[model samples]
Target: MSAKPLTAREAYQVLRDIALGVRTMRRLGEKPLTGVYSGMMSV
Candidate 1:
């Protein structure tokens, strides 16, 4: 992967994909939990 930050449009697309994936997972009865962190992080 390139070590470049995503552009505004790219970031928006990523966020959309993430939201769609979460919705799909929920529909499939999958408990997808995302963990929020400041320094250390996880999903």
Candidate 2:
């Protein structure tokens, strides 16, 4: 399927969300050292 491109505001919001997610992970990816890490991950 084909769709039109997002408007400027829409694109900004989308990118903002992605950036926030990355920033959040970067800030919390390693710390505390008190959690079980099996073989899978979910959010």
Candidate that would win on lDDT: 2
lDDT of each: 0.50, 0.53
Scored by lDDT, model 1 comes in at: 0.50
> Per-prediction TM-score, please?
0.46, 0.46
Candidate 2 residue lDDT tens string, 1-43: 5558788997677668768885232222344444465433322
On a 0 to 1 TM-score scale, where does candidate 2 land against the true structure?
0.46
Question: Per-residue lDDT of 1-43 in model 1, one digit per residue for the tens?
Answer: 3357778997677668778884232222254435432232112
Task: After the best TM-score superposition of candidate 1, give how far the Cα of residue 24 lies from its true spot, in angstroms.
Answer: 10
lDDT of 1 at 6: 75
What is the lDDT for 17 in model 1?
75
Alpha carbon deviation, residue 19, candidate 2 (Å): 0.5
